[model samples]
Target: MADIVVRRVDLGYFVRPASETGTEHARVEPTLGYLIEHPIGLVLVDTGMGRHPEVDAHYRPRRIPLTAALRTAGAKLDDIEYVVNCHLHFDHCGGNPELAGRPVFTQRSELSLARTTEHTIPELIDHPGARYEELDGEAEILPGVVIVPTPGHTAGHQSVVVTRRDGTIVVAGQSHDNASLFTGDVLSQRAGVGHHPVWIDRLLAFDPRQVVFAHDNAVWTPGTSQVSAS
Candidate 1:
């Protein structure tokens, strides 16, 4: 397999309501998506924020429409061959409708919740041309790209693992919200001191060269000396 390129798609930002964040003051977070340029085809991870009056009033999202975002990433909507939504949250799968007919890979459990519960925007999940390829668990959607369950933010949340000649990259969409949180989890796992997700071990096994997140711009790299949160 040829070396794959993972490009960050800036979906824009949003302000989290204080009540929802459990913080005294609302916090601002970036909504990001990833585009994996593979030899076989392009795979998009997470769309942008979905529109809803109540959600808008709560999140106060400043969205960069999916088309524009993809353009900035050096691609177009029509160029995307497959879609992998880390989870079906409104902010994550917002642009799913646009890529209808393309196989949108999602966890079966996540799809069930998104359909039966008030999980995400209804239309985003079951649009006119929506085509979902629900997976029961971990599956390799591409030659060197694997989707592993990383539930926490959501029950069926997952992350993408891309292995290149140099090293591995994990697109941990909202897996830990930010790179710092993910780093802390890694540190905790190392020292065996605090609670961390079981899937953290799975990700660690990959020894990722860099880990990116959906809500934070920072990237997590190995080594405490090389750790970068800014």
Candidate 2:
């Protein structure tokens, strides 16, 4: 099998409240998305930021609009053949409404909540061109590209597992806020001490070459060291 390429898309950033960050003061964090350049087709993960009065006041985001961001990544909005939302948060599914006819792979539970509750921007979820392929569990949407349920950030949160000939890459969208938090979970799992998510073992089973995040720029490698940026 040939190698599959994954590129990072900068959706933009937001100011997270101190309460949410567990810090003395608020912190600015980047919102990231991934572009999987598979031989079969282009798969876009997370669609940047959704806008709303309340959400805007809370996160105070500075978005890069999906088309512009994709352009930076050498892709066009029309080129995306499939969409995978890590979860239905406002920031992740911002561009989904524009994606209209494409097949969007989302967790059944996540979709349910997004529709029934105030989980995300309702317009984004039930727009005119929305077509969702709700998955009950893990599914290999494309060759060597798998969507595994990593529910913790949300009940239906998921991470993309891309297996290439050289190694594997896990696009863990908000599975933990950043790489450091993921490293803590990995260490906890290894020592069998701290509380970690059940799916931690499953992700480790892939022996991922590198792990990326939605809110952090750093990439997590197998060793103690970290890749500052991709």
Candidate 3:
């Protein structure tokens, strides 16, 4: 089998309140996507922002076209055979139209919610010929790549886990806002903190070598090993 390589695609940045504290002004956060080059085929995790007046007013997103973003990662729109979204949030699946008819993997519950509720921009979710492979739970898309249901940020949110000879890397799309939050959860589990999410335990079972985030560039490795962004 050929090696699996994961590359980060910078989709552009957006400004939002730095924290839950509503008083403060906005701060910029990077909107990131991932390209997984696998022997089976190429998998894309999250498409960048989509265009909508409401969405534009809310997040104030600065986006790079999906094609250009893919090019930056040494890939192209035509190269992606499959797509997996962490969730159906406007910022996450904004570029779905670009992959029309492609098999986009997402949790079934997420699709249900995206359709009925006002959670995400409706236009982005139901683009023309949007081929979606709705998953109920965890399922392996390829031999070494699996989409795990890691619902916390959203009801049907999912994360991608890529296993390699070296170790495993979890492309945790907004699983937490950043690696630090995920690290805290890991530490909480190690300390036997009360009543953690079942998915957290499931992710811990993978014994991941590194964890990547969508909003932040920092990487969290096993133990206290962390690769901070420069």
Candidate 1 structure quality by residue, lDDT tens digits, 126-159 = 9999998999888999999999999988898999
Candidate 2 minimal-lDDT segment of 10 residues: 221-230
List pairs with backbone clashes in candidate 1: none
Q: What local lDDT score does residue 146 receive in model 1, on the 0 to 100 scale?
A: 97
For each candidate in turn, the TM-score is 0.97, 0.97, 0.95
Off by over 4 Å in 3: 18-23, 225-227
219, model 1: CA deviation in Å? 0.4
Angstrom error of the Cα, residue 171, model 1: value is 0.3
lDDT of 3 by residue, 85-124 (tens): 9999988998899899999999999999999987688888
Question: lDDT of each model, Cα atoms only?
Answer: 0.92, 0.93, 0.88
RMSD of 2: 1.2
In order, what is each prediction's RMSD in angstroms? 1.3, 1.2, 1.6
TM for candidate 2 is 0.97
Task: List where candidate 2 sits over 4 angstroms from the true fold.
Answer: 225-227
Evaluate model 3: give its lDDT: 0.88
